[model samples]
Target chain A: MVNWIGLYTLTSREVGRFFSVYRQTVIPGLISSVLYILIFGFTLEQRISEIQGVSYTMFIMPGLIMMNTLTNASSNTSSSMLQMKLLQQLPDLLTAPLSGIEIALAYIIGGAVRGMVNGILVLLVGVLLIDLPVHDIGGTLLFLFLVSWAFSSMGLVMGQIAESWDQLAMIQNFFLTPLSFLGGVFYSIKMLPNWAQSLSYFNPIYYMINGIRYTILEKSDSSVMTSLWMAVLLTILFTSLAILLMKSGKRIKQ
Target chain B: MPELAIQIKDLKKSYQDVFALKGVNVDIPKGEFFGLLGPNGAGKTTTINILTGLVFKDSGNCLVFGKDTVSNYRFTRSKIGIAAQELSVDWFFSIENLLFFQAGYYGINRIDAKQKIDSLLKRLGLNKKKNSKLRQLSGGMKRRFQIAKALVHDPDILILDEPTAGVDVELRHELWNYLRELHNNGKTILLTTHYIEEAELLCDNVSIIDEGKILKKGSPKSLTEDLGKSGITVQLTQESIDKKLPMLDLDYSIEDSRIHFSVKNPELVIPKIIQELTSKNIAIHSIKTETSSLEDVFLSLTGKSINE
Candidate 1:
């Protein structure tokens, strides 16, 4: 059986967990977004006029939204799972009448919700602060949701593999953070040399940034179809891997 | 035949090369209070984990209510609730909220679980701290909350692994009373502990396990009567201490100017020993006889103290 009630309860608990700590989970991302806008968007706009058809401050809004979305989304699941493992609370969930898929799905939904909330809040900030345009509101929301789901699943994978807080930080600092910055978040890949542009194509996060950019600004360095396909592929890939690890009871089970 | 609540056949589990359970077999009938008594590293927790589906056995069958734990996990798990040995809980959650969530995990809705949650809190004397986060509770409160969480779903069988380990005497007694009440209400409980007193007090049957194998299994009274031995101690005077002991055809050892003899009936042998000592001119300062307990049975079977 699907255990819908169990899944719902677990997902709500995950959601309530982050909601209870709004100061730590929600405010920090919004505050960081404002800082990025004031420091990078305003100051750098005076030096460089506009990247696409929009002002420099407006140009970086999509990237800021993507950055906050993926970061919060991934961190929600990673931290939650890792903390439960470290505290030895996993046996409660494991011994419950929930299947592996149900558990993973609950975690994914929790992370995705956090990710989407942060991403949308950043979008609202951009629209209110700088009058940032939304070329396709429906497409923008869909893209944000896809990116959140994908990164949240990936975060569960990282959480399952890393045994300690230090290891999780290493994975986030060395991998996710670097990839987000290099994924052409602040600037388009066109600004990069041909060699760097070729390397950017290999960064999956680039497609997420490019996809969100297309929906919000109606402008993208890569093909719109390519970005959409990349988001879909990554979502399926990470979700499958998360479910697999959960079913095998890797690390979380003896 | 009366629908055993738990059954294990040749249960074996190994971590790397070291075995945690080796061909273990046990059957616990419905509504029976069973205890698995063993010291540290004796596989008590491992056996509980296997039965609860938190661990996978290398090769064996663990059936709860006649359903295989591995193949029929949903049914088996839903019927058995476990208060694990480790204090594993989310510290951020309040006791009430955690109980609600636990009930929800068992497919019970909020309204359906409220009464059970309230009753458990009141029964465990945790109603006052219902809103307190788990981290803010004391050790004894945390233990009670663990049991509450396990019972919120109202499973047929409750498994407590070392429930009273490290608890104070008063709280231990309180928990024992609550557990006894639950048992009287027709709840089957499987209790594992190294405390011989706990097993003797709470369990109807006990299996004495040592080093991943069960050495003896029976009622506490039966085991003590069958495997245990009574003994008499005679404190000798200074001059008689060095004298050769009487040829009593029994297991006897002399230490610290006292002669100790292990016999079945201390009353029958005490007079014979007193007469033998008098004839040898061994002056006895005092004499004391002791009856064997579960601890003595454990010592005799394992050849060492249970706590050792």
Candidate 2:
């Protein structure tokens, strides 16, 4: 039986946790988004012109949105879970009537909420400052939700695996950040050398960036369906891994 | 017969190189105030942890109300509320939020949960500090909050692991009174404590565990009668100090003008001792009898103090 009340309470607590620290969780993403818009969009637009028919400023919006979504979603769960573990407060959840799947879903929903909120806020910033025309509002929202959910699950998996803040930072710095930067966030794959483009095909985050760009700009280098499928696959992969780890009592349980 | 709230059979658990529980067995019936009496590393907390699904047992079975704890964890967990030994809390949240969340975890909705939480806060004397974060509260207040959290869910079984370990005397007595009231209201409480007096005062049945093994189990009175020895000390006059004592078969000692006797029954031996001393022309100055306590029972069973 599902514990609906427990699940709701846990999810709300997670959301409220990050929301309470909005200065640290929410504003940083917005401030950085504005900075990127000013530095890369306006300053470089004069020299760079356009990437794929849209203006240089317009082309980077989707990538910026996805970047914000990915970072916030993943960080929310990873930090929350890690802090709870380190503080030995996880017994509150473990000893509760909640099952492994219910716990995982609550955490994912919390992360996804943060992810979606930050992603949409960045998109709104784009719309407000650049007068950026959104191609499809519904599709953009759907894509944001899916990507946020996927990355949130991935964050939970990371949280389960990483033992300390140093370990978590290592995973983010060496793996997440590098791949995110290399995943065509700032430029199109067409601009990269052929070798780099081939490597980009191997990067799952590349598909996420590609999907969001297509959703917001109505232009893409790859098929949007493949991007959607990749998002679905990542979501299943990380969510299943997270639930399995929780059930097995890997790191969170002893 | 009322079903046993807790039943364990040859339950075993080991952590790496050390064994925390080695073939331990215990049964506690419904509405009974049971205590797992032990020293620091006696596996009392480990047993509670396993029962609450926080730790896994290496072998044997543990059941809550005839339901296997591991197999029926959801039902078992929902029926059991535990206050852990350590102060495990999220300092960021207020006491009210913590209790509210705990109630919700047991399937209680906000409306019903609020009433219960408010009553709990008032009962625990924490209503004034409901909005205070854990770090802001004193150690005694935090301890009270922990109990409040455990009771918030209103589980069928309340497991308190050293609930008053670090609290002051005033709070401890208040907690004892509150616990007695809870027991009177028919809440089956399983308490684990190293404080022998606490166990003797509160528990109807106690299992004295040491080094992960149960040394003895019974009511405090029965255990003292069976395993403990009473002591009788008689202070004699200076003139009788040099007199030869009677040939008593029991273990005894003489110190200056005092003669001490260690016997199973102080009541039965006191008259014989008085007659024997009187016949010998020994004058008695004063007499004192000490009843065997649970501490004495624990000492006689384990060859050491429970506090050690």
Q: What is the interface RMSD of each candidate, in Å?
A: 1.1, 1.1
* Model 2: pairs clashing at backbone N, Cα or C within 3 Å: none
lDDT of 2: 0.89
Residue-wise C-alpha lDDT for candidate 1, range B184-213, written one tens digit per residue: 999999999999899999999999999888
State residue B134's C-alpha deviation in candidate 2, in Å: 1.7
lDDT (10s digit) by residue, model 2, range B193-293: 98988998999999989888888899987898798878899999989998888887768898888889987778888998999889988899999998898
**lDDT, candidate 2, at B243:** 85
> What are the TM-scores, per candidate, against the unseen true structure?
0.92, 0.94
- DockQ of predictions, in order shown: 0.63, 0.78
Worst 10 residues of 1 chain A by lDDT: A49-58
Candidate 2 wrongly placed segments (more than 4 Å): B238-257, B265-282
* lDDT of candidate 1 over A159-201, digit per residue (tens): 8888999998998899899999999988889999999999999
Q: What is the TM-score of chain B alone in each candidate?
A: 0.83, 0.88
Per-model clash counts, in order, read 0, 0
Best by TM-score: 2
Prediction 1 global C-alpha lDDT: 0.91
TM-score of chain B taken alone, candidate 1: 0.83
